[model samples]
Target chain A: DVKVTQSSRYLVKRTGEKVFLECVQDMDHENMFWYRQDPGLGLRLIYFSYDVKMKEKGDIPEGYSVSREKKERFSLILESASTNQTSMYLCASSLKGYEQYFGPGTRLTVT
Target chain B: DQQVKQNSPSLSVQEGRISILNCDYTNSMFDYFLWYKKYPAEGPTFLISISSIKDKNEDGRFTVFLNKSAKHLSLHIVPSQPGDSAVYFCAASDRSGGGADGLTFGKGTHLIIQP
Candidate 1:
């Protein structure tokens, strides 16, 4: 079985603070994705990396960025956290043509 | 524009009955479809998938049906259990390759099993 682990299961931060969410996968999949899930809107892609040091902006990537310094690790960074940024964030990894395995998710609250 | 759409926001069914969740997509290029189940405070988990070439794919009590002409697909859960209550998301993918492009997801449908 594939396992994806997120650094934090829950987090709280004040407005204007910078936040980092980490995710690691044991499968060594080539594709890693970051998504923010909100009520009524569902899962919206934030960013994705196909390989180390390569990233692409998803549908919603305004205040978020990503880093893939290693094959098994991917990080999501918020330059300036805002109250509206509070939501459930999910990390997923997949090999080409295969189903994606997701982490437990990080629920971030910005106050 | 929303490429994939789940018209129904929620559905309720009694235990031991069949629960049907529907999904539609505007992108004709989508050749693969998937269903994911998500519980509160948890990430979505892959359930079942169907390729465009096949009309139906079944696994255990869960089944997925696809209609290429209508660009629609559905998931049917037989003998719905209370534990099956969760948010179901439908996703579509145009191609499957080792790249950053992931599947496009719908708004999701919350299935409530009435026991």
Candidate 2:
């Protein structure tokens, strides 16, 4: 079975602190994505990478950036965490014309 | 604007009964529609999908129906089991650009299976 792993399952950080969320996929998928999910608002895309060293801004890219240094790993970075940035973050990977496989989400809370 | 919308936030059905979850979209350009089931504290799992060219797709007990003219779709589960209690999300995409872009998702509906 394909596996997608996230570095952290739960995290708490102080306001203004820098945060890193890591995602790794073993399927050699060509597409990786980061999304933040909130109650009533659903999942909103933050960023995505289609290839190594390439990234694109999604609908809600503010305060977040991504790095895809390798084909198997993608990282989401929060330059400066804020209270409003706390949410459940999800990582997903997919190949062309295939369904995306997701990692167990990381729930982040900024105090 | 929410391109995909799941108007019902929650639904309850008895075991061995039918459960129907509805979803609507505003974008006519969306040609692919999918449903995902998520358990608490877990990531959403792919359920079933239907393309705009076809109106219905079925996998075992799960059936997905699409109405292109109205931009509406639904997931029907027959003889719903207790394990089926989870949140369901509806997603849509155009996929015309080739590469896996992003999928617009609905808010999701929480389904409760009663015994």
Candidate 3:
């Protein structure tokens, strides 16, 4: 079975702070994705990486960036956290043409 | 532009009954459809998927039916148990949509099973 793990299950940060959310997948899949879920908006893709050091913007990718230093790890970074950034963040990985496996998700509260 | 849409935000059904969740997509180019189930505090899990080549796909008690002309799909859960209660999301991807493109998701439908 594939396992996707996130660094923090819950986090709280004050406004203007920088935050980093980490995700690791055991399967070594080539594709990794970051998404944010908000009420009435479902899961909106923030960023996705198809290879190490390569990233692409999704539908919503403002105030957020990503890094893939290693194939198994993907990180999401918020340059300056704001109250509106509070939401549930999800990480997913998949091989091409396959369904994605998701991590437990990280709930970040920017106060 | 919210290409994918799940009109019903919430649905309530009695346990052991059939729960039908509907989804609609505005883009006809989408060829692959997928359903994901999300529990409280957990990320969405892939439930079942159907390609454009087929109209119906079944797995255990869950089945997905796709209508090409209408640009719609439905997930039917028979004899739904309490564990089946969760949020269901409808997603779609076109043939050209590469892995990096990811899947477009709907707003999601919350299913509640009452015993």
Per candidate, the number of residue pairs that clash is 0, 0, 0
Residues A19-111 of candidate 2: C-alpha lDDT, one tens digit per residue = 999999999999999998999898888998889998989889999999999999999999999999989999999886667888999999999
Candidate 1 achieves a global lDDT of 0.93
User: Which of the numbered candidates is closest to the native, going by highest lDDT?
Assistant: 3
lDDT of 1 at B14: 99
Error at A8, model 2, angstroms: 0.4
TM-score of 2: 0.98
Which regions of candidate 1 deviate over 4 angstroms? B96-98
Worst 10 residues of 2 chain A by lDDT: A93-102
Error of 3 at B42 (Å): 0.8
lDDT by residue (B1-115, candidate 3, tens digit) is 8899999999999999999999999998888899999998998999999999999999999999999989999999998999999999999977576655488899999999999
lDDT for residue A21 in candidate 2, whole number 0-100: 100
- Residues B76-100, model 2: lDDT tens digits: 9998999999999999888788766
Candidate 1, residue A6: the lDDT equals 100
